[model samples]
Target: MHWQGCDVAFLTQHGKQHLVGPPIEAALGCRILHTEGYDTDKLGTFTHELARPGSQMDAAREKARIGMALTGSSIGIASEGSFGPDPVGGFVPWNTEVLLWIDQKQDLEITGWAHGHAQSLQKPIQSLQELELFALEAKFPEHRLTMRPSHEDHPAIIKGIHNVPSLMEAFERCRSQSNNGLVYVENDLRAFCNPTRQNIIRNAASDLIQKLQSLCPACDAPGFWVDRRIPGLRCRVCGRKTRLPISEVWHCQICKMQEERAIHTKALADPARCDHCNP
Candidate 1:
């Protein structure tokens, strides 16, 4: 077997293999082994009730590490996701998917990363009459909706309400118990429940596969990838220094060597972007 061809174990309980495994195998020319009955929720979950064990990066790394430890494979992979309003700046919802690739043989870790904006539904609804408006906006039945009382006094929160009958029951259930007599309805973004999220996961998997195919110029590591940014982009109009990334800092996880290359040519930001010039 090629050094990089060792099998990679994936730690997930949600059948993520349906979305994450095939492309990785094709790209890295390796096999994917899944850990059955592995409760990833112990590490963390989508619901805020169960706190994640660590930072997103840490959680992903540990998940991979545990898989490697259990399977006795030097290589392991895992994916983690964060969903909410845009992390940078936008009104739309965004999903950040992170894939961790770890090689214990070389003590190397590289991440395949992707982020995208998705049309997600999040609004409060008091009755079944209100769902019609949200259904149109969210494209209901295709994209599932979740529900919980607007004023949650107990742990029994309604989740994964897809159909109209189920949604009505959940809304009324919450309304009867809630002090506010309202329900918080939003999109159910679980990949299995939501098709839009599944597509994004597939896209992230493809990006990870591409990263595995890359080789570092410094040490020739198979998963050589970008780790940081070199900031200083010129604004397109004013030609002043703005805080945009000028280059991507690529590195070899095994060797710790670095390479910096500009993603584009502009060296400074336009005065329009500069606070001193614009403000």
Candidate 2:
């Protein structure tokens, strides 16, 4: 209970405090000082208006830093989310959420991550009927949408279309303004707009809570979790090593302590995963 009754700053404009704040407060007995003093959209936006400058981790760190500065708190937390194709299948849409916790008092930084299927969709529509179909597939109303004239990058964009009437209005307006009679529609990725992404953010918060609770055996500092996986699992058939991890390396950031623990799921990797045998 290192963080019991501690105050931490959290900066977000998309209502992420509701999704990320409670669990940490409940678990660590910390107070979440939510603030929207700065427009986080300036860092990056899902509508492509402003491109995120750095890597996902960098963005989250910057956000936490800003929150700490704004609230003048020693500790801060923030969450960032990205959407793309799933890594394994490369076909289904995927969402990855990262939650960063920075403790200036202890000079410790910990991150939590979660990834899963995302209800994200985009398409060009020429008529209201097509817009309806796309909305259905995009999980409209439940998950809000953004519309732009002609293409996704168009500057004339309408966002937060929650209901059918607003959706129709945005479609017609964009369609009329489009040079090619097409309106680009996509699921609004803001945490408040998209419930699917919100759920992923919640999971990321849960991960952060777990990491925060795992105290280091050496220094009694939090966030003593697996840092990396060692890959050298032997192939079951050929006895050759594969890319699969044979053990995990747990490290404590505060004390710089390390421990290697063997994975016991399977003694040998599958033959199909062996590079030499498969190739």
Candidate 3:
């Protein structure tokens, strides 16, 4: 509990503090000082109004730094999320959440990651019936939706439509402004708007807590976790090395300490996965 009794600055406008603060404070005994002094939408937005610059990790780190700067606290935390197609099949929608912790006193930076299915969908609607159908699929009232005239990049966007009345109103507004008589409707990807994204952010916070509890054996620093994998497990049929991990390399960012632990699971790689055997 190195962070016990410490004040950690958290910057968020999407009500993420409620989701991430409780577990962290309960487990680490740190104070979460919520800050809204800066507008995070300037960094990036899901609605495509302000494009997010740099990588996901970069955005999280920048937020943490900004929070620390604003609150003048030594430690800071921030969360960032992204949506895309699932990695395995590249078909289903996917969401990835990242929670970053920056401790200036200890000169340490740690990140927690969680990803899963996302409730993200978009459609072009020409009628109220089409809009209602899209809302049903997007889980409206609970998940919320955003409407824009003509296309996705339309500046005349109406956000945070929860109830049927609001949804209908926003749809009509966008439709009236639409030159093509078509409105673009989508799930609002904001954490407060999307419950699924909120849960993923919570999971990411739990992951960050786990890593924070894991102390580096050599330097006693936090964030001791697997840094890389050593590949080349032998193929079962060919008895030749395949591009499968045989061991994992746990690392400490502080002292740059590393420990290679061999994997004991299935001694050989699947023949189907082996280049030599399958070739």
Best by TM-score: 2
| Per-model TM against the reference | 0.84, 0.98, 0.97
* Best of the two (2, 3) by lDDT: 3
Name the better of 1 and 2 by TM-score.
2
Stretch of 10 with least lDDT, candidate 3: 127-136
User: Deviation in angstroms for 96 in model 2?
Assistant: 1.0
Stretches of model 3 off by over 4 angstroms after superposition? none
Comparing 2 with 3 on TM-score, the higher-scoring candidate is 2
After superposition, the stretches of candidate 2 with alpha carbons farther than 4 Å from their true spots are none
Computed on alpha carbons, the lDDT of every model, listed in order, comes to: 0.75, 0.93, 0.93
List ranges where model 1 is wrong by over 4 Å: 1-5, 150-154, 232-242, 264-269, 274-276
TM-score of 1: 0.84
Model 3 error, position 221 (Å): 1.3
TM-score winner between 1 and 3, please give it.
3
**TM match of model 3 to true structure:** 0.97
lDDT of 1 by residue, 1-279 (tens): 233466888887766787888777665678888985467778865645577867889999888988888787888888888887887676778888888888777776767777787646777777667867887788787887777776433456777777889877877787777667677777776666777777777887887777777788877777777889876776666665567788898877667788887786555576766765678
| Cα lDDT, model 1, residue 255 | 76
Tens digit of per-residue lDDT, candidate 3, span 93-169: 99999999999988899999999999999999898888878888998889989999999999998999989889878
Error of 2 at 126 (Å): 0.3
